[model samples]
Target: MRTAFFVDGYNLFYGLLAGTDYKWLDLPGLLAHVAHVQDPASHLVSVDYFTSGVKPELATRGIQSKEAQDTYVRALKAKGVQVHYGRHQLDPAKAPRFIDKQTRPSRQDKVDIWKLEEKETDVHIAVSMYRLAARQASLAEDGRIDQIVLVSADTDMTPALRAIREDFPAMQVGVILPHRAGIERPPPGSLKDYSHWMRRFITEDELLAHQFPARVPTRKKPAIKPEYW
Candidate 1:
């Protein structure tokens, strides 16, 4: 079974790897482990990772995040993962204006802050999945891309998954929830409804096991894991 993987980088980070020491991940290695366990015969066609650059308006933290992200992206590209970029939009209107009762006294006005929302990543993932599925469907008779795997717990992808399943009934649509092993709940709504199979949750151990080296020596320069990461 030939397979292509679509990963929601933010979703995977916050859902599983955030606050963990596994931030420096090896995308292809993790997917290879997944493929080996799910279908040993599965041949990797491609891996599309969707994420947005950190918002520069965030100042110091943002700059640091961007540097770390850049290193990680380079590492992923070196390992043959296709990186897709989306823009980060700052929404000032959504920023909190009132002091939270839980954190502080209510007398003072809150600071003006920009909420960074990732734009077009979901659309990118959806379009890539659909386009790849369509192209592979044309060669389905030759046994190309037997499965399309989505690595997300976000329900927004449900529509695209449905479209792929409806448009090409022969190809299998699967989901891999990027969460811890014990919290096994699938995403609610159409995603769960459309998924033909749900792969196991990505484990903490797996993330630890499949990490890029601290110093990845690329041709141009060494891509090292950020000290803060």
Candidate 2:
């Protein structure tokens, strides 16, 4: 089976790597690990990673985080991961709202708080996936994709997955939920209801197994893992 992977960068980072030692990850290695575990026979054709650039002002580490993220993005591209960027938007005048899911409030309380939102990632992923499918749909049997692996737990992607399944019944669509190490973080049943299959991202053993080296030697510039990560 020929497969393509679509990764939601922020989703994976926050859900699995945040506050963990897996921040400096090898994208290709991680994808290989996923292929080995879930569908060992599938041949990986491409890896599309969607993410937003870090804002220096909003980040806790100021410019340091942005620099590190830039280096990481470069490294990913160097290693053959197709990096598609969205953007970060800062809304300082926006009010912060808190919602209690259990008890519905008529109007939630709002406080003045600076908000940093990552935008266009969901749309980018959806569009890219559909484009890939459409392009492959016209290709020869050997050149066409047999499966698409979406490495995200965001429920917003359900509609796109459903459309892909409906449009091309022969193509298999799967979801891999971003999960913490040793924790059970299953994808919502609603997403599973549309996908051909669903699985949790490998967090502990696979993360350690696929870690990037301390230094990545690139032709343009050598990339180093930030110490604070």
Candidate 3:
């Protein structure tokens, strides 16, 4: 089976890679392994990673954080992963303050803050997945994508999966939540409802085993692992 993978980079970072030693991930290799595990016949065709560039001013390490992200992106591109960039929108906003874990947020108690959002990522992933499916429908059976795997815990992708399931009955849809094995997070029911199969979590062992080498060669300068990563 020919398979394609769509990754929500932002979701994956926060859900699985944050504070972990697996920052130097080999995206294509990891996804290919997962695909093979799901089906021994699976052949990886393409990997599309959707993410927004890190906002330097908002990042903890400021410029260094941005550089690290850029390096990783370059490395991923070098490894045959197609990266699609979305923009980060930073805006002044007001929202109810978080008082305590047990206390409900009240509109009366609001605070001003900078709201940073990754724009167009979800829409881009959805459109790309649908477009690929549509294109595959027009291609010869051998060239068509047999399965589409979504690597995200975000429920926003549910509609896209549902549409594909409805329109392309022959195309199999799978969801791989980017949750870490030790983390306790409920799987999003909506995503599972639309997908043909769902992988709940990525083990630390898999991540550790699939890391990129200390340096990855690109067309120009090699992409080296960040010192702080």
Q: What is the C-alpha lDDT of each candidate?
A: 0.83, 0.84, 0.94
RMSD, one per candidate, in order:
3.5, 2.5, 0.9
Q: Which ten residues in a row have the lowest lDDT in candidate 3?
A: 135-144
The weakest ten consecutive residues by lDDT in model 2 span 101-110
Q: Report the number of the highest-TM-score candidate.
A: 3
What lDDT is reached at residue 73 by model 2? 85
Q: For residues 98-183, could you state the per-residue lDDT of candidate 3 as single tens digits? A: 98899999989999999988899999999999999989867888788999999998999999999999998999999999999987
Of the candidates shown, which would achieve the greatest lDDT relative to the real structure? Answer: 3
C-alpha-based local distance difference test score of model 1: 0.83
* Model 2 regions lying over 4 Å from their true place: 93-109
Clashes of 1: 0
**TM-score of predicted structure 1:** 0.86
List ranges where model 3 is wrong by over 4 Å: none
